[model samples]
Target: MLGGISIWQLLIVLGIIILVFGTKKLRNVGTDLGGAVKGFKKAVHEDEKDTDKPDADQPQSKVSHDEAGNTYDVQAEEKAKQKAENNDERK
Candidate 1:
């Protein structure tokens, strides 16, 4: 019994999901999800490279954010704060 659910119960839920969405649809969904994850990882790797070779003219936003405005790195927050201060000073 895992998490108060039996093996049979888990199988039943899986069967229902399979029935509802069919095998082909599920395969497509899995493929799409894998592609999205691969793209995200590639972008992050590129972003890391860009951060290493800093550009003077373009302000680098080392920010990796989510839909709800949640930042991935603590350093991003500090950089944003510093940027805000710099902008405020210039005005």
Candidate 2:
């Protein structure tokens, strides 16, 4: 018994669903669901493969410059923002 519903009760509910929606429609819905699950698994597997390998093109530290020609550390900027937030909260 699942949630106190007997096998016979489950069969009746399934029969009603089939009657409300034809077999063909149900089959199509099932096919679409299976395809979505398959694609999700494939994407997760690819992500795992990507994380396992390190690329040479990616630098150990990343830097970006602006039009004003000011140089700043990427991590330092993040820390600065956090400090500003803390100051604002204190005020």
Candidate 3:
């Protein structure tokens, strides 16, 4: 038994799922899910490289200004925070 369920029980659940979605649709779903996971992993790897190399010895957030004396760093920080929020929402 595994997790309070027998092997036959697990097989029954799998059978039900296969019956409901059919083999072809399930295969396509699995392929799409795998591709999505691969793409996400690649994106995270690339994002890490970009952030780590650019500010290796400094903080992730920095301060800057424009000709009109408007602060830009805070805007950048807000954008980054919003991006993080979006990622969390996806999860």
Count of backbone clashes for each model?
A: 0, 0, 0
| C-alpha lDDT of all candidate models, in order | 0.91, 0.92, 0.90
lDDT digits (tens) for residues 1-91 of candidate 1: 6889999999999999999999999999999999999999999999888778747458667885457855489898899999999999999
Off by over 4 Å in 2: 56-91
Question: Candidate 1's error at 28, in angstroms?
Answer: 0.4
Task: Give a tens-digit lDDT track for model 3, residues 1-91.
Answer: 6789999999999999999999999999999999999999999999889877855777567665546755469888999999999999999
Please give, for residues 1-91, the per-residue lDDT of candidate 2 as tens digits. Answer: 6899999999999999999998999999999999999999999999889887877457678675556766669999899999999999999
lDDT of 3 at 25: 99
Error of 1 at 76 (Å): 50
Segments of candidate 1 deviating more than 4 angstroms: 54-91
Task: Tell me model 3's lDDT, rounded to 2 decimals.
Answer: 0.90
RMSD of each: 19.0, 13.1, 16.5
Residue ranges of candidate 3 with Cα displaced over 4 Å: 55-91
